[model samples]
Target chain A: MRLPRVEDIEKRIPRPEDFTARSRGPATTARVGTALGIAFGICFLTGLWSHFQYSSPGWLPIGPNPAWLYRVTQGTHVATGIASVPLLLVKLWSVYPRFFLRPPKARRDQLLDVLERASIGVLVAAAIFQLTSGLLNIVQWYPWEFSFRRTHEAVAWVAIGALLVHIAVKLPVIREGLGASVEDETPVHSDGPSRRAVLRGVTVASGLALVLTVGQTVPFLRKVSVFGVRDGGGPQDLPVNRTARAAGATRAASDPAFVLQLKAGGRSMSLTRDELAKLPQRTHRLPIACVEGWSRNAVWTGVAVQDLIALVGAPSGSTVIVRSMQTRGAFRTSELPGDFVDDPRTLLALELNGEPLSLDHGYPCRIIAPNRPGVLQTKWVRELEVRT
Target chain B: MRLVRGLLLLTGLGFGLWGVWLMRDFTSEQLVSMGTFLAGGVLLHDAVIAPVTVLLGVVAARLLPGRTRSVAAIAFLVWATLTVAFVNVLSGQGGKPDNDTVLHRPYGLSWVVMTALIAAIAATVAYRRRRIAGPPRSR
Candidate 1:
């Protein structure tokens, strides 16, 4: 089918030059885009670190020594993502006129232009996906079947990749825009905010967006982060990912027959809650930092994970599967890596904040270790099967 | 600079394609879900959001006095930009039936506070701009 000529279709769409607003210039776009670039860069790096926690490439050892590492990293990731919402929108508003860019008459320029536009399409789509899906994930809402983590990771790369290419393609324009004044033809009787005022508004609005929702991570800011999914409030003064009732472990956890079993190298040992408590109880201050980016420090008191494994004759630094009696959910059984278990601070916690573990906070027993994801803490822990 | 730009472009395409390749095993449903949001975002912004923004600017310019129009436009820009992001969480779908602590805060009230604060700030800034300039200036 013969398509309409480029000039024929151009009549229906406004050309980039037709946008005459003094504030809607490349300078405003470049400034907002620069801030957005930094936000995305920080968010991507921190998100990659959060991803590495689950699947470490072994280039860096995710040590348990620094209990606050993931807390800070994931907190920054979520906070930065939140802040970028307004930044991205404002940037798009400034750059929207460019979407109507007319094709060049030169064939070579047209080809390059098409390629650049395609790359921009990819960037915009991927960015919108990342921000929207991330927000949904914060609320634990999964409207689709594909894995959130996997798709989120894959699309993040796409966004960053296209973003970098966009920078390359626009480098000359960006340089020129940044050097020039935002005001075109000495302002000439404008109606809305000046280019400078718009930039300031964008910055202030984005900062407000961030400060309002960052309380999930910043302890002192908890009261103000009403939009934060996890409010740093739960049983025993720490957020709980899963309740005993939700995990279907309430009956098993509260039963008088509850005993923690240890198995390693053809040897087996079981100890009741009282028996486990009597074996050199130790207290450690550790934060239950979650992947969703909420964390709280608590005084966890119980037998050390290394000590519990020793009863089954497992050597120190043994890898173990800490299985929870809440058998129905994901991460019900978490692998405690050799290095993590070797640390004396790793504990099968029985007391939280000087009180017995609340029924919702993993009743009889739970795994409390340094720098571990909250989901992998394996609440209502029943069996410690040493693998190494 | 040309060499750097070329290298960046190539590396970017490589990474972007790799991300696309990762979804080779996704079911049709998954792909559709992904595409819906991806394309929907662009369409929503370009077709709906942009046009409304332009229309509002034109309407405000024609109908309202200059000062109120300018301040309102900026405040709307700030509020709408943020509201689009806050819509999902505000839907209350995030709340868990058994767990009251999860998403337990009054987000609706928070949004109201956010709007009031943004309007107040915008008005204050506009008032100061007028005060400092010492005369009513054209936008």
Candidate 2:
């Protein structure tokens, strides 16, 4: 007996033509593709905004006034990603026929088919990577060794590029399918629901996916957001990513001998937590907009970073590097740009809401800046090196 | 239109290839693992998930006649999509150790309740469709 080749096995399996559902056609594919494309666009833009928080490229300037800008962008990123899951599935299923499509007879047409198939494969792979990696990241699961943030950003460009190429290739088909009525599309013989039914099903599924997990950012919906990763419950009603125990900062942060080291130029000054608190205190109600997309606004009272740096003779245009007492982690120290240092609202926060900072909330002191990701908040501050 | 299409294709290819090129410095292991995941997702969906969905639709259609067929389809769409989206959460990984608030709900129970809720809604949809069409009439 001859060995079965991959193609032979594939031929035995159900091809796209085997799917006789009325929903699996050009009309349904076009409609779902339209929705999925929009979702992908929104997700891509917002994801870029969130990624900028980490790299801070000079060309794209993000302001501090809208303390909720990162909140909105990151929130939209995760939510749109969640919503896109169903639409993506539906879109792929509707186009499953393309996988089984044979090459054309002419050499040029065959070449074009091969190129289209290759690009489609790349697009599908990149899209799935972006969504799945994002979902896994939010829950802090790293099954792979590669850096999620770096890999995610790199793949995002690939995905968007492939999407644009796909649009270019299918523009005529898309226009034709979209322009004509769904009822008028070329259909395979089937005993299934109308195109409208499939569309409605996809919409409802996508919408459910959104509302079910968006409560992490939209506070009011927390109760109904059954699958929301972060419930917005922690110290001072703020969610915690790295706690005192988790960071191994409990003992070091609680030490009475602890003094925040403030350095400017070649000089350094030290102040105890109480002394830092006794200095001119300012309160800024800023949101701890975490990278994981959970955010909550809290009233934080502490010494302004500028004021503390001023005592050490660091001027208005100075940049400060906030260092944490946390024994372990990637963001042990974060550099605040001149703009952030000059911002009057930036504080080395000592209190949260109306109460003292909980151990999990970076007790003693934490950096709170408007429109900043939580990781850079620099909890359990041990040093502030101001450079003019 | 030709110019537009060409520009789109070139820009897309240029940018995409550049991105892939930039990551050339990643360790061979990292690259391999990344490729595995990227390719794995497409493979799993195309080979297993899509076929399973098609099979489910066939089964649902055969088991239920008339309008209830649509009900089964919609219900499966909602439940399967949501479940897959929250697969990590349902897998007990969402509730991390030492953190009480992250994915705090009993997800297994949540999944059960969610399934029942979907079934209930599906039953209602089936009932309404039955009333609207007043049962299947022979051709």
**Mind giving the per-residue lDDT tens digits that candidate 2 earns over A173-212?**
8887798676735545755667887888889889988998
Q: Write the per-residue lDDT of candidate 1 for residues A1-388, one digit (tens) a residue.
A: 8899977786988777666556877788899999999999998899889888865566877879788888888888888888899889988889888888777999999998998788889898889889988888888787766788888988998999999999999999889889978665575655677787688778877877787788888889988777778788887888777777778988898899998889997899889998988899999999888877778889999989898888888887998998888857777888888889999889999999999999888879988889877788888988999995
Full-model lDDT, candidate 1:
0.84
Q: Which stretches of candidate 2 lie over 4 Å from their true place?
A: A1-15, A184-188
TM-score of chain B of each: 0.83, 0.90
RMSD of each: 2.7, 2.0
- Ten-residue segment with the worst summed lDDT in candidate 1 chain A? A182-191
Instruction: Indicate the docking level reached by candidate 1.
Output: medium
Instruction: Write one digit per residue (lDDT tens) for candidate 1, span B1-139.
Output: 9999999889888988888898889889888888888898888888998889877877778886666666777788779877876776798786568886688888899899888988898789778867876766554
Candidate 2 collision pairs? none
Q: How many pairs collide in each candidate, listed in order?
A: 0, 0
Q: Over the stretch B1-100, how does candidate 2's per-residue lDDT look in tens digits?
A: 8888899899899869877986878998889989999999999999899879877877877788856776787778778988888886787764458877
Q: Which ten residues in a row have the lowest lDDT in candidate 2 chain A?
A: A182-191
